[model samples]
Target chain A: MAISGGAKGILIFAALALLALALAGFITGAIGAAFVDKFSGDENVVHGWTGDVLPLDQPAVHLAPQYVFGDHAGDSLDYDNKEAKKYDDSSKIFNDNSFVITNTILSSLVTSGVLIFLFVLGTARMSVVPGRLQGLLESLVEGLLGFIESVMGAGKGRGVFPLIATIFLFVAFNAWLALIPIYQSFGVIEDGHLKATFLRPAGTDLNMPLALALISFFFVEILGIRAHGIGYFGEFFRFGNLLRGRILTGLIDVFVGLLEGISHLVRVVSFTFRLFGNMTAGEILLLVSSFLVAFLFSVPFYGLELLVGLIQAVIFAGLTVVFAAIAVAPHEAEEH
Target chain B: MADLGFHWPSLLVFLVNFGILLAVLYYFGYKRILAMLDQRSASIRDSLSEADRVRQESTQAREELEAQLGEARRAGQQVLEEARQAAERYREEEQARARAEAEDFLRRARTQIEQERNQAIEQVREHFADLAITAAERVIDRSLDRDAHRDLIERALSESAEAQRN
Candidate 1:
């Protein structure tokens, strides 16, 4: 009976993989024809994969001035151009960045929602011998915990594991899910152009990265404050206690402290750009690859992006854990 | 990257999304799952340690039982040996006492037999003397008394007893 359990485990895994493969094939079959039929147009309609390029701002339809007075195709084309121009002018007058929600924000919401759903379902019934969802989540949790413990001591790792792991899963899922042939390929046709893609990978957005950076930045600083009280400020503005000490040594200490503070502050920018740039570049690379060499050659690049996506998540989470450890460690504590 | 420039609305949306994610994940899933994992691992470890301790205790008890069995065997042998030795000593003492009593009885019987034999011989010698007297008296028609023969027999008996003593 015990031996049967082992065999059953293998059989289950193989069956699940086969089922997934079959589902993917079925989806590609259903959607591939429609995509080809729609996009297989003349060369003028540039199959912009990234959708970053705005195709030539051409008229949606023919219009004429006479069309306003009488219903006619020629007259409509003449009048439509003026109407379009007037709409553009008014839009320009009131347009502000405040209301301009990027595709990344929507992607981010989708990413978070998916993660929450999976996590909730996975952990709903946690048997000691886990089910499928629990098994997957356990592996992820254990792996992140191991990484955290390896960087920080086991005691300190527990404190920051949740935050780092959350960031990692959110970022990584967005990156990989963004590549699943859905984010950019499908969108509503607007004004004779495929504008306003409904989904974008969260990491592709600068704002998402900035938000993540701010989160990490605040966490690190908070940890420092908790660990050392007001003394953590010494790492930054060391000159506060300056002239009341050893003169030459104090000046060097203050200057070094200032440099350290600057470096610490710059980490927010570094974090933001690093993750945002990597994920965005990865998407662009995949899009370009797909365009250059249809499906066959594109497969390898997809695989490459998968690896890259994983690496980015690991780097992001790993750095967060390490930084938290460094921030929380007391100055007098010897380095492990 | 047409809209790659800064967007204030995007920032707020991202922050809001992240905030919701943090709350949902921490409250609904991660907290419980992590606690369960910790509890399970600790339970497993405790069970393993308990099993090890039980094994150790059983092994120790078995060894003690073996040692006690060996001691019991040795003590049993010692008791058996003591019993055999006591039986042997009792048999030897009984045999020696029996032999001494038998020798004393034999000596007393010999003394009584010698005295009886001497007495019988004296009676036979007196009877023979009386028979001779009677035969002579019958032939000559006279009676004779042989009491002097008894004295002779008594003297011989005393000498024989002194010889036996020497």
Candidate 2:
């Protein structure tokens, strides 16, 4: 709380130096270079000022994760160059040789590994009176279970908790992990540029979200069917009124059922795109901000991305819970 | 769809990855944590009920002890009251017996004194008669009839005794 004059002066000097570095970063960035070029009519202001340093290149975004390591990694495949007869039409992108591990897949494995390691370490020695790690894990698990139970009611929530909680933890951890500085900087560098980063957020890859979406879809539908028996399909097919000699109302019910069916299927797309879009946008925002102004400017956006990660995780898991709750709830069979 | 990066292998890998994670986590984490939580809550409930039972038992025991003490105190007081009454009765009986004995002794002593006084009075009357005869004979100094003197003295004494009695 108390500082001598010299320490205070040093603190002030450090603060000023940090500000000066931030200003220098802004001045050397693309916008500053453009401003200089516009004002002084210098065609290559960036080249003149930074001398050998190239301006930040546009961020390369791949919808499919690049195969950085395992099985045919860095192997350029030319269909025409392959044995003309052996390369069959059925085997387009994937053959025996094409089952390579992508960067996103590797990242997913890492994320899963981290989760496993944490769980193993936390549960190695468990007691009613928990130590720090166990206490933390217990509280986190309890909170997640409580949230699920709040939506699904107490006894039934435990059934779907593992899947829901996993989805949330996977998505959130992937986003947050990718935000680490090393994820951007430490990678296989090729020709003085990054060829592929070893770690990328799995949510940015379409397959990851698609996989999770499909899982959630199956989970909800299966639970619904299990709870209501074969009668669950009756929700999508309304022939009760048709049998009762009410053609007009029956047709309306049919149309509504059709809409309901379509909406249910559409949840998969919505789930996939929502996570993919936000994650991609956050990654781009971070990339662009750091490119535009190197250091201090992107800090706030990083904080925002943290919030975004948590929100997306919650939305994904929370929606699954709500959908599951609705699925198992009793249908209005008495409307007839 | 291809341009948007729909790859089958990646999807399969992700699904498999998630499945394994779920299995491992269920075994190692959620199941144990939930069980521990339930156990803790159960133990707490049991302890609370146990404490309540103990308190009730202690209160009951205290009440019983107090009741026993009161009964003992009451019994002691009753015994003391009975003893005091018995002692009072015994003292009165002793006083009554002593007073009766003393009165009986006084009556017997009064009868004996009355008998002794009668005897002494008889002896004194005998002595006085003898002395009167001696004095009469000395004054006369003349010989008289023994049987007639004896009869006269007896008659005189008898007449005097009768007069005294009247």
The lDDT per prediction is 0.69, 0.80
Considering every candidate listed, which one attains the maximal TM-score?
2
Where does candidate 2 stray beyond 4 Å?
Answer: A1-14, A35-48, A51-55, A70-98, A333-336, B87-166
**Best lDDT among the predictions, by candidate number:** 2
Enumerate the candidates' DockQ scores in order: 0.23, 0.33
The regions of model 1 sitting more than 4 angstroms off are A1-43, A46-101, A191-193, A240-242, A245-254, A332-336, B1-3, B63-86, B93-166
Assess the local accuracy of residue A26 in candidate 2 as a C-alpha lDDT between 0 and 100. 76
Q: Native-contact recovery for every candidate?
A: 0.47, 0.66
Model 2 has fnat of 0.66
Task: Give candidate 1's whole-model lDDT.
Answer: 0.69
lDDT of candidate 2 over A26-70, digit per residue (tens) = 776666555555424333224325524654444566655666754
- What tens digits encode model 1's per-residue C-alpha lDDT throughout A21-114? 5544333331332353444354444333322243322122111011111112122112224455532211121222223333565578788989
Q: How large is the i-RMS for each model, in angstroms?
A: 8.7, 3.4
For model 1 the local lDDT of residue B21 reads: 92
lDDT digits (tens) for residues B1-166 of candidate 1: 2134334445666777888898898877778778878988999999999999999999999999999999999999999999999999999999999998999899889989999999988866766565555444444543323654454445445544554445
